[model samples]
Target: MTEKDFVPKKYSEIIEQGTVSWQAPSNIALVKYWGKKEHQIPANPSVSFTLKNCRTITKLDFSKKDGQEDFEFEVFFEGNKKEDFKPKIRTFFERIVQYSPFLKDYQFEIHSENTFPHSSGIASSASGMSALALCVMSLEKKLNPEMSEDFFRKKASFLARLGSGSACRSIEGDLVVWGKHKEIKDSSDLFGVNYADEVHDNFKNFQDTILLVDKGRKEVSSSVGHNLMHGHSFAEARFAQANDNLAKLKPIFAEGDLTKFIEIVESEALTLHSMMMSSRPYFMLMKPNTLEIIIKIWGFRKQTGLPVSFTLDAGANVHVLYPEKDKVKIFEFIKNELVAYCENGHYICDSVGSGAKQLSEEN
Candidate 1:
């Protein structure tokens, strides 16, 4: 669907005062999305495994506005008032107000918290923005009582993308694809779509153990990296490669080919870092310990003939991905051999998840 499809109709009812709460999960890209265009459109299609344990819970409280000319809201993170987060949220409101015009009619209080540490090298923007978007959509639902479930989710994802590109993929389940691709039915650059094709049982409940190699923030933000692609020498080839890898994944996912899955996932991870290193202003996100953990994973995988692989984000942390059946051995290997590379031996274990959920008042 196009962005115009998300513009809502006049509300038949009004919700002057109410609260909406939602929990949204973060996701790990199997095929990464590195570059983007204006309006946060992805340069190439990417798919991710939505995570269960690492998530953000957001509660949005709204009441009738008292003569405000602009968007009015307050933000609290982990029970502490965070004034620094307001600017980003304000920008989000400005971007989405055209689609959800009723936002100007209410004063909102956003209470948000994450399951992981604030600076654990994990990007909370995906889960945090998605949770906030779902809460906003929930408020919209109260205004337009006839809204369909499909539209609600699509619009929430659409809005979430404006806040953070990867957030669009956090609104849904085990596998979600963002960005338009000919092979992916109903794929849109505007939002994420669930992978509706037959997925083999081997991938169910796939595990991701994130080892915190460095909790410090990256030197370059994702926005800077994306902008660098504008004049990047190998940008076109990289975008094409992502699409080709995505196509190749179709059969691998359906047939449950662990070997091919490992090949693609690992290559994609390295390719992402390669791009960053090759950019005009070259930089590296992976620390020395990151390479150490990777080498150890390779040794353990080869020794046991298990399908253990790793993926990295725009930071130093490593996300170890493996099938559920290998969890016992893999977890043991991680704790025994790989945890030494982690900062203070900090790590988190998560598995494939079903998506975001709305929470009741009691929750």
Candidate 2:
């Protein structure tokens, strides 16, 4: 559906006060999107594996405020007031106030917490913003009881994208694609679409073990990295390559070609960093331990002839991807050889998950 279709009509019911809570999961892009356009649109299509354990639980309490001209909200993280987070939330509200018109009419208390460390290479913004968007949509559902389930999900995803581009992928299950690609049916730059193609049994329960190489704030934010792509020498070529790889992944996924999957997934991960390093005033997000971990993974995979591989987000952390069958051996391998590379030996074990969940609703 087009963006215009998400615009809500006048509320049929007046709801004075209520609370909505939602849980949204983080996602790892198999085909990474490194650049973006205006309004959080991806420059290249990306597909992600929705994660189960790394998630954010958000609770929003709303009450009608008398004669409030601007949106009113307080942000909290893990029960602690986070004044620093309000600007971002305000920007998000400004971006989405058009579609969720009721936002300004209510004063909201947003309390959120995450299962994983924030800004540690995992997509915390993705899960966080998506949970918030879903909570807001739940409020909308109360006002418009007749809203279709499909439209609700799509609009929630659309709203999530405005907050964090990858967040659109967090609203759905095992597989999701964002950014329009010719080969992907119904794909849109406006929001993520569930990957409906034939997915083989090999990927049904795929695993991702995230090794935290560094838990520090990113030196260069993702927005800066994405903006650098505007005049990047290799920007066009990289964008084309991402689309080509996505198309290639479709057939590989359907056929259960683990070998081809590894090739593409790992390549996509490295290529993402390559773009970062290649941008003018180049920067390197990968730490020494990050490279060491990648090397160890390669050695272990080749030594055991296991279908094990690695992928990275924009930071120093590494996400080890493998099929369920190899999980036992891979997990053992990680603990023995790779855990040494993680900061303070901290890491998280997660797998493919089925979208967001609504925890509670109260009026």
Candidate 3:
């Protein structure tokens, strides 16, 4: 992909250099999306809660370009250069330049950092990519002042999906659905739509405390894991099961049925890992402590009639989910039993968030 491929119908000239900053949160999938089609299309629909604290804040300092050119950007994380992140950003820009032509009209100096550790395996790409996408969308909206907020967010979600399939989910608040589910109105394989209004208030503010079993990068990247599902015997069955779970979840979410919700959420987590274990060239991303934490969560739920459950991302970290009412009870359990399973006795306390925010304009 190159600048030649991007030809917007109306291109605006840059008036002056400015900066745009946006912060977007990572999300935990309730019904996981494990596979993908081309151009970052999800193979199965998934639902997620936009997290409150685990997020990425990206500031893009823009300058008018010398002449017609593709995007030329440098990225930094925590005040240090992150050249490794540039290639993906470049590719993402190339893929979405048609939607956000302002990107090619300026050179960008991007600085990004996360509230939670990136190595914690919680899909920082979802947050980071979404933040960058939001920044681009903000610039485009500035240039095209007539565009509606819905169009801006929709384009941002669409652009973010081009970078990471899960990133689309980060563009919306609270409960969100991604992929083309028959029953879900406005659902699309291209981006995600907010599902907060469709569900009961019980799910709107659920807590997700992440237990970092391994604060290290996974041996297999999520892309490689998704690729493995292509020839797996269980791929078709797994996709169908996800659809079934999603179908069941809609009523449960609306009615606030915690028991059934726990059952589905836990099963989806295990099902995700199960796919990895059953893949053609099998590999494991879960650490020994990951299982220990899961067992403990199950035992605690049984001993106490708490509405607590656990879910895992594509890594070793365990997201211990529970209602806001169960905060004290669940944290006590975490401190007493689960912290020992953590790598450095660490975790992140987060909850359902309100979604991305844009900073004040800077000229």
Candidate 4:
């Protein structure tokens, strides 16, 4: 891609100074993307809900530099200078330069902090990378001032995918599906698109209460976990199962069939864990408390008839999902039993939301 393809000529007089910020939501996939190919492309199509409150907010200040380097940036996490985060961010910038050509021409000072806990089974990468992507695209729009809305979001999603596979989903609203699937319209392996079309009213306000079984970081990073999938014994079948599930789920989501939705979502969660267990390295990521929480949730659902279900990411934490109407009873159940299993009795309340948004320049 060329700079002319993105930046317009009329706004060629580059601005000397400006700050852009974006807050992008974390996403919890109902159908997880475990294994990936080169360039962070998903092996199978995965669907996720854009979370509301749990997110990462990033602010970027750019200054035009005479030397055209791949990247020159400073990163701060929370209020402190995060030297460890700089390496990853640098690598991300190098990879994204092709998509955001103007990125190579600026000196960036990026300050980012997450609303939810990082490295604790939450999709912090999704929110974090998507926020940075939004900032970079917003900066480009500042230069061009003529980029269309469709070009803005799509390219941001594409650039975010280069940093993190699941991050593409965080750029879009409600629900998004990534990976090329024949059954879904407008799906692509490079980016994510809205797959929640014709979504039932019942699912409009779905809730996700994250039970932190362990607040500590995972023993294995998701990168290493994904690498292990390269030699997984069941990798082929797992991908097939995911595709089949995606096909089965389209009508279920559109028809508002909660029971079938629960079945597929829970199975996908278990299958993700199962793949981990069956990997060539054969390491366990789920805790005993994870099993306890699942069993109790099952028993509670059987007894109370509340339509709540659970899904897990790459770590031991549990993301409890249910309709908004059952919030009272579900929170009650969480207080009485599930909290005991959680790490430090901590949990986060979030739900499906309308993707991410840009921030005003001032306080």
Clashes of 2: 0
lDDT of 2 by residue, 80-185 (tens): 9999999999999999999998998999999999998775566599999999999999999999999999989999999999999999999999899999999999
lDDT of 4 by residue, 245-348 (tens): 99998788789998899999999999998988888878788999999999999999999888899999999999999999889999899889998998778889
TM-scores for every candidate against the unseen true structure = 0.98, 0.98, 0.95, 0.95
Clashes of each: 0, 0, 0, 0
Using lDDT as the measure, name the better of candidate 2 and candidate 4.
2
- What is the per-residue lDDT of model 1 for residues 1-363, given as tens digits with 9 covering 90 to 100? 777888886889966798889999999999999999999999999999999999999999999876758998899999998999999999999999999888889998899999999888899999999999999899888888799999999999999999999999999998999999899889989999999988999999999999999998788999899898888989999999999999999999999999999999999999999999999998889999999999998998899899999999888999999999988988999999999999998999999999999995321
Residue-wise C-alpha lDDT for candidate 3, range 43-152, written one tens digit per residue: 89999989999999999888888776677889999999988988999889888876666677788899999998777656799999999999887777667677778877
Give the root-mean-square deviation of each candidate in angstroms: 1.3, 0.9, 2.7, 2.4
lDDT of 2 at 54: 97
Task: Give the Cα lDDT of each candidate.
Answer: 0.93, 0.93, 0.87, 0.87
Name the lDDT value of residue 38 in candidate 1.
95
Give the residue spans of candidate 1 off by over 4 A. Answer: 361-363
